[model samples]
Target: MANLRDPVIGPVIRAEGLTKVYRSGPVEVQALRGVDFTAAAGEFVVILGPSGSGKSTFLNILGGLDTASAGRVWFRGLDLTALDDRGLTRYRRDHVGFVFQFYNLVPSLTALENVALVTEIARNPMPPAEALALVGLSARRDHFPAQLSGGEQQRVAIARAIAKRPELLFCDEPTGALDSATGIKVLEALTEVNRATGATTLVITHNAAIREIADRSLRFADGRIAEEVVNPVRKAPTEVSW
Candidate 1:
């Protein structure tokens, strides 16, 4: 593992010769095939791909939700592929935040308490109130999940994910469930959080409109990165449209 404190000397995330395979009964499926990837610190990256393009699988491997059958992943200097199950769990809990398509907020808890759930156990987390404020949800802190719109609920989820100030933020199909107008707000929240926290952020989405907000954009196909492009200018999320 590299010294994580070292400032952008190398890739914040690096993966080499990665592969993932799933086996069930007599069926075997490959999700990623010989893929290599690198992400710099504080970079906002977006992965664009169709269904079954392996984007989520790659994000999962990076975020410690799933293991790669082959290859190695380096987070700063830690070898994720080499970590045992317990190590991966600790790594995820300590250094990574994830937002999915669904809000997944505890329906019983108010937005504030939902975010507080993670901050309470995090090593050096900001106050739950602060996290909520970051996503422009300070006024909704006491609202239950059912009382909020899809966009608001998603922002709450983002607040929870980032409350710990993790080094990485992984979002899988983050806007898939929202309408166009609501989705824009979610993306704006994500972009704002990325800029404010300087966390290396990666979002997976099928929508091409979201690509404008990324510093780097990747197209995935058949379990591999088909094309990668760097943006000289990043468009604000507010400018993106369906």
Candidate 2:
């Protein structure tokens, strides 16, 4: 495998001529259209798009949850498109952490235990307590999902995802279900974790305001990236409003 840290090829992830098409009984929906993307290590990139714009499809393909109908993806110069099922699974398990819209915590498990579920199987992991602390939930380690607020539960989910110290983090609509204030808190936690862990972070959301907090933002429309913006200085999560 080639090294991403080499100055000549500094991107941690790269995609070329990406496309996705969903088919059913002679009907085909093109979800992505020849997309090209790259992200450097430790960079925070936000993708913004309305429904059906293909942002989610792009993320899922890159994160190994779904395969592209056509394209090639590279992670640290490893060709992801060529990976078999087991190789993809191992790649996801070892290198990626994911946060989705819902907190999928086990109802009966405490925050710490829920986090421990991942650490137990990881090759190397931080203590569950430390992961909770990273998300500002150290005091709630003993609380079950039902006992915590939605934001708190989501934080616990984040703690679980990061406990294994993955190199990349992918978040899809992470704040979609929260109110503005709670969403801000979640964004703050995400930013904190990104800074602390130096994970290459990618967030996909419909909220345009959230773009203000990222190093770069891409706007998707009609299955293509319509605009790209680089933030000279990212706004603090607290400063973002939607």
RMSD to the hidden true structure, all candidates: 1.2, 1.7
Worst 10 residues of 1 by lDDT: 1-10
Question: Model 1 over residues 1-242: C-alpha lDDT tens digits?
Answer: 45555576788899999999999999988999999999988999999999988999999999999999999999987999889999999999999999999889999999999999999889889899999999999999999999999999999999999999998999998899999989999999999999999899999999988888999999999999999999999998888878
List TM-score per model, in order.
Answer: 0.97, 0.96
Model 2, runs deviating above 4 Å: 2-9
lDDT of 2 by residue, 1-242 (tens): 55433443478889999999999999999999999999988899999999999999999999999999998999886899999999999889888999999999999999999999999888779999999999999899999999999999989989998999888899999999999989998999999999999889999998999999999999999899999999999999999867
- Pairs of residues clashing in candidate 1: 1-77, 2-77
lDDT of candidate 1 vs native? Answer: 0.93
Assess each prediction's global lDDT (C-alpha) against the native.
Answer: 0.93, 0.92
State which candidate has the highest lDDT.
1
